[model samples]
Target: MDSYAIKYIGLLCLLLAFVSCKKKNQNSLPETMKKDFVTINYAKGFSIEKPASGITIIKVYSPWPDADEAFTYALVPKALQTQPQLNEKEFDAIINVPVERIIATSTTHIPALENLGVIDKLVGFPETRYISSEATR
Candidate 1:
């Protein structure tokens, strides 16, 4: 092959190797309270950890069906005015306690929120027409 062809092949091979290596760096969660996180097993889909008082870490495994990875959310008290001392990579999002507003996506969640006495916090729901609860309607 000519010099140009040989160089092109070398660069292509290097790019392919880099892409393969990057894919291997991704991580996933089992939600069974793996070795790294504290064993506050919430369920097969999530794990709860309390690294500090009034601060909760909820690691949701497989956010979507058969998802390859997981997401972690930090629920901190609004009064704290600060986040917990955890790794920057530990959580994907941070939410405040006493959730002021809610947008319940599932009908199943509505009953539970109502029973918890926090149905008033629901500001938005897609399927309000399907609800039979007079209080929620």
Candidate 2:
């Protein structure tokens, strides 16, 4: 074969190798988010992706009325179980699994959080008097 043809074939092989490596990396879970997790069906403004073990990435777009900014939160599931050995730098929030403590600002979030059995995690609410939850009462 001609030298030019040989060089082209070598380059093509290298490109193919690079592409395969990238696909493999994308398909493999990162060390932090490898464990099992529940799928969250979120609204239009938010989406989730698990790229590693014990971690979840949340993307929020225009989450607030009249707001134009988008934000991201990297959450660690069963945080207490993983946080001891986890690199905290990998996540934006490290809420304990079966959450134990929380401060609530809106009653709107109560019912869903309560139904999840994690409402007990609320230790404080700014409007305690407004809350009528039988569990909290």
Candidate 3:
């Protein structure tokens, strides 16, 4: 091969190497972008009280409408006997409840609840006409 041909081959090889490197970097993402959890310190405004063994009560504002009282619950780690079938692996970690009773407050939640075969548990609803389908009604 001549000097020009050798030079052209070297240039082509360098271009291919750069293209492959760029493609590899595009496939990989940073750890911060992949993280799903967000930590928040909300203990500043709330008053913590110890009731008994394995019971800690905290007074906090309600996240729902028409709630006059501060929400209180027994913060305990309960074990699950049976596992539910979830679409994604992350959903298994997040959802711990059996979801026996579901209150459809809006039209958007009605159709999905009906499809999941748990429509009978929907004892309370906002408005029928807004979410009532032909079959659901």
Candidate 4:
């Protein structure tokens, strides 16, 4: 072979080696490890502890009427009485008392009480048809 042909073949081999090496390095990362990477925002001077896989966050209204009713109904179960920060333009925290017995007068109140697991604490009702099954009747 001519010197020029040999030099051209050598250059082609070098280029192919570099391209294959680049591809191998890119694929060296495990797919699961790459997929699990997440971005988190932290407030100034705050750091987060790594969360467990099944941990969940739910946004709850702070100091809701149900919270008050729960408070009045049974002195506020420790799990439900957390005072969350309120949005100044929309809602405000009015009361922090423990609830025991709820007297539901409006249609909306019964459903709210039932969802909080305090349906049995509903001792009195004004309008009855809205409630299912005349059990309370």
Which residues of candidate 3, in runs, are more than 4 Å off? 1-96
What alpha-carbon RMSD in Å does predicted model 4 have with respect to the real structure? 14.6
TM-score of 3: 0.30
TM-score leaderboard ranking: 1, 2, 3, 4
Candidate lDDT values, in order? 0.78, 0.69, 0.55, 0.48
What are the per-residue Cα lDDT tens digits for candidate 3 across 1-137?
99999999999999999988884446645542342222336644345544333333344555366667564433332342243322343221232335556677888887887788888778777777776576666
Task: For model 4, name the residue pairs that clash.
Answer: 71-98, 71-99, 72-98, 72-99, 72-100, 73-99, 73-100, 74-99
List model 4 lDDT by residue over 20-64, tens digit each: 888444555454233232335652221222123222222233335
TM-score of candidate 2 against the unseen true structure: 0.55
Candidate 3 clashes: the total is 0
Backbone clash total for model 2 is 7
Give the per-residue lDDT digits (tens) of candidate 1, residues 11-38.
9999999988884654755543344456
Model 4: weakest 10-residue lDDT segment is 68-77
Deviation in Å, model 2, residue 34 alpha carbon: 11
Residue 64, candidate 1: Cα error in Å is 3.6
At residue 35, give the lDDT of candidate 2. 53
Cα lDDT of model 2 by residue, 13-116, tens digit: 99999988884346765575565434656547667776655456676777789987777666556643644655556554555544567788888778877888
Q: What CA RMSD would you report for each candidate?
A: 14.1, 7.6, 17.2, 14.6
lDDT at position 106, candidate 2: 88
| Each candidate structure's count of clashing pairs | 0, 7, 0, 8
